[model samples]
Target: MENKDHILLFRVGKSELERIQQKKAEVGIRSMAAYLRKMALEGICIQLDLGDELTEIRALLGRCSSNLNQYARVANTSGNIYAEDIKDLQQLMTEIWDNQRALLKRLSDI
Candidate 1:
């Protein structure tokens, strides 16, 4: 109906044009351009969320790696786990050690 006010018909195939109209109705959009804009905005939002998620994951991993190292140092120096964090830190160190040992041995051989 809005197209009646416009000079351009856009000349798309029947199926494609129908799909565009269907999506426009589903999104409660008033025009084809608005539907297209909504689709583009959704795509951009997904990519932004993915990037933020990856950044958070990397930050957590860095914190885990740092905490493991701190635990190893404190255990080696203090000889006792007086604090809960110290105990948890040691467990993290052990987990890191277990994971790295396989690679460490291979690297040492080379």
Candidate 2:
């Protein structure tokens, strides 16, 4: 590690401090000093807003899991599975892949 011996002190208003803290949390950085240091040196931070994409992916996964459970129950009781049930699962999987690809594309653009 490089020597970080110098101390830089600064002051901001209440709202400014809150904004700084919010940005730090958004980027998943725990240390305020480290976050401020990086921002000061780099002068730019790229924060991706992926909440919607991730939420959609999570919903798709939940549906896929529920469908699998239902299929398993039906197969266990009747020893038969329908083609339509499999098709629905495949469609859910395809949607998940599409969302993942879009997310990846956005990340790559960043």
Candidate 3:
């Protein structure tokens, strides 16, 4: 490990500080010093706006979870599971995989 024996200090304007804080939050970094150091050293931060993809994934997962719950309840009470329920789950899985692949492709492009 490298020993830290030096102090590097700098100042930023109010607007600049606000921008830094905003970017830090966007990247989910809690330490301002670390964020600044990373920016200074790496000089490249790729912030992907995955909101739409995440929302779609969440909706699909919710539907899949609801279907699974219903199927479980039916099976518990009736002691039998339907082929249709299994098919629905398989279809949901396919959609989830497709979305994941699309997201990966987008990330790889970056």
Name the candidate that leads on lDDT. 2
Candidate 2 lDDT, 1-110, residue by residue in tens: 99989999988999999999999999999999989988999866799899999999999999999999999999999999999999999999999999999999999998
Judge candidate 3 at residue 102 and give its lDDT. Answer: 97
Off by over 4 Å in 3: 1-42
CA deviation > 4 Å runs, candidate 2: 1-42
What clash count goes with each model?
Answer: 0, 0, 0
- Rank by TM-score (best first): 2, 3, 1
TM for candidate 2 is: 0.64
Candidate 2's displacement at residue 72, Å, is: 0.4
RMSD each, Å: 15.0, 9.6, 10.6
* TM-score of every model versus the real structure: 0.33, 0.64, 0.61
Query: All models: lDDT?
Result: 0.65, 0.96, 0.92
Pairs clashing within candidate 3:
none
Runs in model 1 lying further than 4 Å from the true structure: 1-49, 86-110
Evaluated with TM-score, which candidate comes out highest? 2
Q: How far does residue 91 in candidate 2 sit from its true spot (Å)?
A: 0.4
